[model samples]
Target: MLQTESEINMFNASLKGKLENLSLSSFRDLTILNLSNNALHGTIPSHIGSLTKLGILDLSMNQFFGALPLLLGNLKKLTTIYIYEIGIAGTIPQVIGYLKNLLDLVLSNNFLTSSISLTIGNLTKLTSLYIHKNNISSSIPQEMELGNLKNLIDLHVSSNLLTGSIPPTIGNLTKLTSLYIHRNSISGSIPQEMGHLTNLIDLAMSYNLLSGSIPSTLGNLTKLTTLHMGENKVSSFILQELVSSNLQTSLIPPTIGNLTKLTSLYIHRNNISGSIPHEMGHLKNLT
Candidate 1:
């Protein structure tokens, strides 16, 4: 029986209360469940794993607590799962790697800790993954592979306790437009392979223990708009190359005058030395 529009709205709104005692076997044609921003509390019902046809499940901004249900992996067709900003605690369930069709997975701003699972490499179709602002520590999963995510665009894993060098293999994500891996304990040199990301528009790798000269190859990022590598151990020469490149800021390298299109530059708080280039006077926007 087809319900009226108002009736359907009422049903969805009260569905949580009704599901308090719901058994997974009773649900039918319920392919999309979005209980976000609701006051729903308690662990997700284990029976939810039976919803094999669910495409999107959002339970964010709630008081739900406990480890993510491993049973959700049974939803093979799931595309997006947002469980961030909730009281969800514990390690991410390794079973998440089973969501073969997942495109966007956000579990940030939670109580999740421990190293990311290597099984994440299995989600080859993912485009956006946000697991930042958590208590996760240790070197980035060296085994974490993303070579198959050719369509990936944004990756944010900042503000955590991550350590070790960033893998050069990350440059394999040629389709990436934005990459943020800052405010961590990451050390080592910025991979020269990063220049391969010609499509990158914004890149941030600050407040870490990273040392070495910035990759000269980074000058190849003609599409770049913002580049933040400050607070790391980088050389002034690389900063000059960034200034001559596509950056759009004034406080950057004096060579930045070459980027006639830059409108806002911030290069303060570093070992950068040398007088401001007089050529900067040529940029009317810099005046």
Candidate 2:
């Protein structure tokens, strides 16, 4: 068996032809492929789908164009796929659902559009995902589609045009550490379900349209370090209005004192009322 399937790193080679002669049948045992920072141009070959043994594929900082190859989903063992700033346009293929073993998926700073598909929920093993800074417009899809990514850790999908509410099911990502969905058009109350992310460290959802009282559930995140939830309508004005109107929801549950690890906290621009509990002094780590 050809042992060529071990590691093929051609990062920043300035190679041209845009994958024209990039054939892989001979390298059936291939595992890692890094072609980042190159001059490669043209459509990704469909034959790429046949590389079932590939684990890491990095094609970032290239000039590749056209829609992402659907055949990419064929690589079932893929652990990481970085396609950042590749000039590739088109919606993320639903076939990516096949990568049950994928760990990281980065496709940021491109011209790509469309919303994340529900099929992404199948990547239950995903850890780090960075698909922000793209034109992927529209609200994030419902939790019924991607609430199963329980192993997710760092999710940075900021700087997009994403609308809609933060899905409560996101609490299912109990292992999350850094969650950055800021600078979007997301509206509505911050999901109390978010409190379940006990492992979370950094939570940045600022500059959005989120409302309602900050749920004390967040205090449950004992590991939290950075919390940015500003520029929303969650102030006491809205809170009092919501309470007087008896529209929906409750108040901060004093349980917030549990986040002893928190260092940076940004809760301005909201309608949050009530006096700061003395328990807040227990946060000796607060900065």
The numbered model that scores best in lDDT is 2
Summarize candidate 1's per-residue lDDT along 182-244 as a digit string, tens digits. Answer: 889999888888888988877878788877767767767766666666666655364424422
Best by TM-score: 2
The models' CA-based lDDT, in order, is 0.72, 0.77
Model 2 off-target regions past 4 Å?
A: 1-5, 236-258, 267-283
Q: CA lDDT of 231 in candidate 2?
A: 62
Which pairs of residues clash in candidate 1, taking residues 3 or more apart in a chain or in different chains?
243-256, 248-262, 249-264, 249-265, 250-265
Query: lDDT per residue, candidate 2, 114-216, as tens digits?
Result: 9887788888889988999998886776776658888888899999989999998898888889999988999998888988888888888877887776675
Total clashes in model 1, counting residue pairs 3 or more apart in sequence or in different chains: 5
Model 2 lDDT, residue 113, Cα: 91
